[model samples]
Target chain A: MSMPEGRMDEQTIAMRVAREFQDGMIVNLGGGIPSLACNFVAEGREVFFHTENGALGYGGTASLEEADWDLFNASFQPVTPLPGMSFFSHDEAFAMIRGGHIDISVLGAFEVSEKGDLANWAIGNMKDYNGDVVAWIKTGRFPPAIGGAMDLAAGAKRIIVAMTHTTRDGSPKVVKKCKYEITARKCVSLIVTDMAVIEVTSEGLVLKEVAPGLTPDDIQAVTEPKLIVADDLKEVEL
Target chain B: MNKVVASAREALADIFDGAVILCGGFGCVGGMPSTLLRALSELQVKNLTLVGNAPALGLEAQKTAARTMQVPESYADGSLLLKNGQVRKLIASVPAMAIYRLQEPFPIVKALQEGQDIEIELVPQGTLAERIRAARAGIPAFYTGTGTGTLLEKDKEVRQIDGRPYLLEYALKADFALIWAYQADRYGNLIYKGTSRTFNATMAGAAAVTVAEVGGVVEPGELDPEIIVTPGMYVDRVVVRQGETG
Candidate 1:
């Protein structure tokens, strides 16, 4: 039998994170939810979305033909480049990111620890592979080759991961420590999930806010690891 | 070492009671130099002229010694001092954009609208970079094709270049420049890897004293010259970092 979709789905979580963006943000939206973020950025936020192919100030995807074939998000998905945008070599592109021009990096993740360790790119046995997992996906040529995730994970003012609270098999993606390879050591600042909004802290993973129709218990039960509930935990609006 | 100190308190020592500083960076990238900025609290330096992009850390910084001149951007923590009438003047580019992030952008705008001396000077991004470069290069001023024939012409000195009127912009230099670097040789040569080069390189040559806090400190001759963006001649005294990562 086909499964039914829930009311507050993953897309809702994506929008919630997008709204957090403020004016003058030079944000790098990763391949997944990050790319979707353009639709939700508020009308006046004035965020300049950057892609690997040297396009900046891009937003809101339009007709497929109108999209720049060469200018795409991290995933190489055809996207519309915004105005006041410029183009440059892909390697030079990473220089801008490495130069600390980016404000926030909103990404997708497979696992996260209480301290916000990330493991998005590599989860398989590293002893065996050469660390070209992005190439293994075979979508398109990644000229820059995901060159800056490590830098982004380390240098960006904030690193926010957006993912479903649980895995398809009902397993909690949030754990005491991630099972996959660590992308960054204790780098996560925020995690937006379908059921809740969590902020990583020194003490432990704290449940700052819960999602709609999800009681504290409902989220708590599904979350394998015990979460520290802030004294003022409230329902997450965005 | 000149009995060197690290923490923000110790770093501000040489910052005079009154000085003009042109910071480097876009937002946190090159905006404010760390060691100098950190030391600023200790210097408690008062009444200053400054320029450049701002760090994401709002507009004002801890103003213990004294307050900054003009409230460049509203979010600047330093503006608190300016608003209290502690400062004499405040200036910034895109004062409207600066005040936009605040609780009330227009009160400042209204002050400018209702006549509050309107000390703001709106400058184009590329022109700002060019002027800073010319200032560092020791040129008095240069003309650019950017603001020559339009509304920007009124703000700038319209000069004839090749029989055409071009906007004349003066070179902008600073008494001190605070910067961040990936690593520094004891000789004062700076190597900025990744996004660290933004405005820091331009300000390095433009300032009288450039103080840098690097993530790593190394002996001379270790770093590749090709990677060195700023030579040691431009940097005055070098201050290595005390346990900084990323």
Candidate 2:
């Protein structure tokens, strides 16, 4: 099988995920690629961004000259505040997440199971090592930082995972079951990856859109489980 | 009725060995009581158990972004305590050494690598905040579905609530709470600037002694009652930062 060509880059993947945003939606964008989605929200559509660190209705990343260490996003990047922006305590911020107030949460993942389980926090045998720091470091594995991913996964009304289809070594990231530490169980609703746009449904993983020039078979080759191709499956639109 | 202290060192003067201190902040120095942490370091108090969001990126790691960001030269965090071998354990959500300068050598990681007896308990960010808030609100325990199926659920009590599984978490309390705020009244009413509020607001009154490091202090009635994020009653002491007017 020939390797698929013209895979979407991080910016393109974020752009595709941004299309899922609706006006006036309160969205929480996790670090890494998910953070880029804020830059691609359609013009005229108003989306309020929430950070777990305690700020809502913030604008995009601030320029160096305008940077304020106190004003930052969940990614720890300085951001500009918008009119009507409000700050709250960490408890209040997480209350918005756990109380079913956030409209959408877009997050990056290490592994996403076919059943929509998320495993983005830890890797390798770090979970079972039992705090043997010397041995753990010798294995070159740093302790995983859970952050707010689990709370966002379990509480956000809808979860959209944005990641590459495969790891750098061509290993599948969309798998039958997550081998890494699970962040949350069966929480993902939509997945926008570099290779395809997939949806987690009651039936199974549905292939909704493939990157341009890639076929359903091409996507399936890199995925772990069999995919249910959508009837209206089409090329990913930027 | 005045709660104002002259300096950070005086604010934390009562901290002793083996005390459990809650340091409030998210990831950056903006939300942290940097001056207090520095004082704690200078005091050389040992065996402290720290509770917060991250383990705190030390001054060296922060220096990388100091050039482009709004970081202050006097910035410090719990890392100062860790570097001084003062912390015995840390309970936090994100325990990573340095988020930006990943390659930098962190004292906590170095101590761990050398097999120093430092313990770290990882909690989800929301759960951590809720736990601290619960302590302040006088709630002993609560059920939440945040860490039901993860490693964090190990040895925890789990119950089915509304057909969903939840882990029972006890309220986390501390001996002292070190926090940062934008302004304070002589009576200790606090108002924070921007996102710097983070854990600071939630941690007030959550500990035996809640100390606030503020940019400035105003007359008791000078601050409008409506805008105060933390009531004066929750704060035990308020310390003005150096070179700032009261």
Candidate 3:
């Protein structure tokens, strides 16, 4: 398999995820790639942005000069509340999620299995680690955050995972089965990566679309599990 | 009868050493009782157990470690309290993200790393909220499937509900709850502004005494009943915004 000349950027992944959102839908954006989707929401589309921090109908990031410390998104970064936005308590916020009021939730993942099992929480137990000590000390054992991702995964009507195709060491993230602790089993519906767009189905992982300038073989070489190619495979549209 | 206090210092006067406090906030922003935290820092009480979202943004630790970045104003809720070494234990969800690790670890994580006296018990965000809500609602314990196969489920009772596993969580009641609101009346009824209502509303009545710091305080009849999110019965005292008239 040859290396592809073109790879989708973070903005492109966000744009692709943004395309899945529809008008008037209550969309929850997790940190990282999902959070970037806020900037790409289609103009004139009435997608209500819900922050797990107990707010709905909020706008995008605020300018530094205009930053109101009280107005922020779930990422703990400052945000601007749009007109007619409402606030609730954390209890009520999760109630809205568990009650199925949230139409869709976009989250970042570390590993997604063929069965759509998510293992983004803590990478396998750190006690078994035999890696560099200083690097381990700097990186720490557990991922620094897992705020409300599990609740969102269990509750959202639909879950879209956004992540890079591989780790920094070029290891595959899409695997036969997640070796880490599973956050939710068989919960992911769609995945938008920097390399390709894939769908998690009951049958197995299906190749939906490849990034521009990349061939199916390039993606297949990195993907640990066998990917079933869609009959109408095409380039991912932004 | 005016239940209004003059300042956050007076509002938190009864807080003793080792007292458990339920704080209300989302991140460094949104619904934090900023004044109360400042007062708590000045009071210098030790061994306090704080329950909240991100009590502090943990930015100062980063600034000290990096020496390159400027530390922003610690306007968030419990930054002062932690900076002053007040917290003994913290029951919170994820306090900070991966970005905070770039320079210095978040205060809580740093404390845990250094083997300090501080302890942290991580809770799922929803379960934490529901536990507090259950206390306010007079519910002793409830079952949820949130932490079922995770490390959080250790020692927690797991029951099968409709063949699905659900972990049992008990109510979380504190000695005092410090929260912020957009507006409050002399009767202590509160109305919160956009995004600032995060954990403030749920924690209102979950403690033995609930103190509210509001942007403004009005007469009883001034606030619309329909818009009041927390009733006066739940709030023990209300303090108008410090250094400003409402």
Candidate 4:
């Protein structure tokens, strides 16, 4: 099949990533891409949602007026609660995450190394930028809101990263080594991006599938490290 | 005889300057004893150290006669305490989300930017909860690997257990704990509604004084004896919001 003409949109990326979610899995969705993925969870799958903010069995996003400010997800978005839902304290919730009870954790990232080092929390060099200088002048550094990403990244049984393939300026997000701060080391299992699907393995980033309309060279040109095409590279079904 | 108070102000009457308060809430939503927070804001007591999940807590939204527009009026969370210069320090996880450049500033973010006499210690969300629970459980300290190699573990004790590093975290106690509950009986047993129970259930006896601001209050035998999450001994005071004076 010929590669698609352009990159996949946000929703498409989310949908592709959501397809990986399995039934009966207790999943934690991080902010941004991971948060949007919940909308695309396959029907008939009894996947239970876990929010690090201490809620389980979370439902869809609620409309503003229908929002019970009390009912919210980890992203702070108003959400519905399915029946048989339960709540717990922070300690118990983290115990669940750190104890390796969470089956899958989908997170967004600024950069991912071939070895699977993840960095998404802070964007260093803000103080050097002209617009951000005034605000960060006194502290000389911006505080990265790490939240619960590290715990989820390190503790989830398997980690899948859902993000755009490239930055707005066309720089590749998948690199040989992340230049930014590392959130966790060697935690990623699969990476579903707008351009391609890759698996993080001991052999390096192995390309599993290319988004429609793209070729091996098309993905290679944008990727920083060398790419290893799988024996049977397929098109990522949206 | 019951522990129910007529006003939030009365329940919090003994709070003094420089007190450590554990305010329950997750991003201004659940487990928030907002009525008591508003009263505390009005009291304007200074130098409080707040420990909780999120930063902001909101009060009742003010509506005009036509109810066309509503404006949030008071400090129902740590932001108000920070705004009033009442907070000397804050210990929390997910205190505020200031992820991007163009996002509008949350009060806690603004306060930090202005360089007030405030201190913030950002704990990993799970670790924060565990520390608070540890206090209530009477466990002095515990070890976990959540932040072992990250910035959060800098200058902290790190030990290797089963070849994995775990950071030593101390229990987090407070002078007072202010929490919200959906229902309470005259004996101070609390029953919470949905997400509102988040941290309130665990923080019940983690402090010297535990005050509950409940939506409804009933007689002693009204609540189901089998499912009471927090027994009356944990809660020192119960402020019934519906019958309370502002």
Candidate 5:
């Protein structure tokens, strides 16, 4: 299949994601794929970004000369604070989320249902020496804190999920149902995968568009769940 | 502080309608504010904004992994608040699957299926602490080294130094903070057992009004200063649990 313009790499995806940004929208970019959107934001656009860890004016890379050990994000990454940004208590960050001040939250999801349910922080079983049933978590938490995914999904009016359409095994990511646990119920608003862009609507997985050369039939055939193709759907262009 | 609640029936006396509160816990390891959660149920305040790490679940499922597909469990804490019919508006970080599932969230997905309003704010563990510290210290805000090129970028006044986007998460101080601790002196110097220190330490100092519930209330100076995690100056009141609550 031919690749779509500005969709060939993560940078392209980052650029495309930036297009969806509305001026003055308060948004949160999750780790990994979601973070890519920061670089592509249009100049003079007033998008206020809040890192859950703390810093309203935090921005771009850590400079060897200007780096402050205390000023960084959740991943211990260096941050640059923009003008007019403010900080509050950690709970205030959650308050900002819980208070309905945020307009959009761009997060990464592991499994997205055809119905748009998102499972971003559930733990599977891990094998111990005895192979006893234990919570398998990325952060070593059993009965882990469901953390902020639920709050972000519930609080934000617009939730955009960015992840591959399927796992490495070539299975369809836009599935009929998820194999992992579900954190938020049908909380996904948009699904941007490597192969296609899907919108989870009441009508089901509406095929927004597939990359160039990849037909709706091709996407559907690879998909385990049934898919709906948009009439007169064209290739996803940059 | 005692005026906040007189009994289980009126546990939510201090909480006004539409108040934003913080629920402190670490997957049941640390001292969680049970009294406050109980109060939420007693008041039955609906359409409220809330934040925490995980939904309070029954002990039965604490060790059980969720089966494939979507399943939303009753939030044990919310259940208590809901029992009183006070929580009309609610927001949290995770539903049931947020307890285990990552890619797909259950509570949010179910809400999405019906178009429910769900708001989630994700925070790193350590950065959360530092921000809380900044609040208690009365600093307008401080900087953390987490969530730069990631989700934390939103709402942050950013400083791009090395081709990375490091966002700001403002310090969070709420109207009321209810936290759990292992012990506290009459003067309010509190101590926690094990990892219970997670969010409680910050909550102790950050809240406008912080009432600490402890397993044991001892006399001041009974404990060593080195062992005391929260100084009495930060704590407003202390209520000791008759028995081990956890």
Candidate 6:
């Protein structure tokens, strides 16, 4: 199949996702592409960045010269403290999340179903038997780690999945059904991918925006489920 | 009364085999009680059940230092216990193996692959924290919507709260808690620096014996009672790390 030209990059995808942020919203950015959205929030908008590790309202990551070992984000990178930043225990931090205080949670997913199901934590690796590849096993080879993703997905007021449209091997990430382990069922509200921006609605997966030169048909070529083009679908804007 | 102990080894002398330990930290050096973990590793206590956010903790510190070029004084974490074969089970949110570095399995994963008697229970990070908090607060169980319709709800009691499914999670109490703090008074009132307070403050009163590894110990009145994160009532013992001023 011929692919569309001018796909968005990780930064562009993050920039597109950041547009969803609003003033006074308490946002939690998960690992990978979701974490980049913290840097792209619109200027003059007051957003509180909550890291599940402990601190809330932290600013951008700290430089090596200004690094403080005790202060870091959920990704384990040293972060700079903001004026209103406050530190709490893990229980309090998770309470803020699981108590439905967080306005939005942008998470990175390996697979996001058309029904809004999320599967991002673990992937089974292939095992060979007698010089032939056998089954994709999860037990001994790849034990899945279910971190705060479930809590955030299930507890946050809104869940937005930020990821590339396709896997590294050119497989569709936005699928009819998630084959891997599910993080949460029908929790994702918005999906911002490198190829297209889709919203999980009551009707179906609604195609909201596509990459600069790509069309809805081009996005459907890669997506596993059929796309419902929005009434005002437009090219993805930064 | 002075709760200060001379060393980590002395503070953890009562830790026996088959003990349940709540180790504090978010997989980084600042929050981890490295001095106590190092002493625990050297003590060679076996069959420990560790509860924490990250099971393979020190590796994150090493990775962080490598990336930022700011090496901590010590990198001891739960891996030391796993390496010594002292941990029989790990109850944590993150796996023993680094999710990023799946090619290199940690000792816990290796033992599991070898069919050894090791168990891993992956709990969502929030549930784990709330369970520990529930234990400390004397709550037996609580209902939460954090793990509904997921693998975490398997065999767990589920009830509908406000038309939403909520899972009943039990308190996760422990035999001992090893926590790190920036400063503490002789009365055991603790204060942590920055994000180092993550699990350290949570696990303080959740265990039978809460041992704090602090950088410095001061007089009771030295610490402002209003600013102390953990009151002395929760902390049973306090040990100042070596090379740190008390």
Reference-based lDDT, residue A39, model 4? 83
Task: Encode model 1's per-residue lDDT on B161-215: one tens digit a residue.
Answer: 6885556778776677766666777777887643345556666767777776666
TM-score of chain A of 1: 0.85
Query: What is the C-alpha local distance difference test score of each model?
Result: 0.57, 0.85, 0.78, 0.77, 0.57, 0.83
For every model in order, what is the number of clashing pairs? 27, 0, 0, 8, 126, 0
Q: Give candidate 5 regions above 4 Å deviation.
A: A1-7, A61-66, A123-145, B1-202, B206-246
Instruction: Note the DockQ of each predicted structure.
Output: 0.02, 0.58, 0.43, 0.39, 0.05, 0.50
Candidate 6 lDDT for residue B110: 57
Candidate 6 per-residue lDDT, tens place, B42-154, comes to 99689999999884545653564447554555667788787777888788887543344533455566555555566667788999999999999999999998878666666
Q: Per-residue error at B174 for model 6, in Å?
A: 0.7
- Deviation in angstroms for A110 in model 6? 0.8
By lDDT, who's the top model here? 2
lDDT of 5 by residue, B91-188 (tens): 34333333243433333333323444434344554445556666777777655434443334456777764753344556766766667777787788
Model 2 ranges off by over 4 Å: A1-4, A127-140, B64-67, B97-101, B243-246
- TM-scores of all candidate predictions against the true structure: 0.46, 0.95, 0.89, 0.88, 0.50, 0.93
Tens digits of lDDT, candidate 2, A58-80: 98878888888778887877888
**Each candidate: fraction of true contacts kept?**
0.00, 0.65, 0.47, 0.38, 0.06, 0.64
DockQ agreement of candidate 4 with the native complex: 0.39
What range of 10 consecutive residues in model 5 chain A has the weakest lDDT sum? A129-138
3 or 6, greater by DockQ: 6
**Can you give the lDDT of residue B16 in candidate 2?**
91
Task: Evaluate residue B159 in candidate 6 and report its C-alpha lDDT on the 0 to 100 scale.
Answer: 98
Instruction: Please tell me which model should have the higher lDDT, number 1 or number 4.
Output: 4
lDDT of 4 at A143: 50
Where does candidate 6 clash, by residue pair?
Answer: none
Query: Where is model 2 chain B poorest over a 10-residue stretch in terms of lDDT?
Result: B97-106
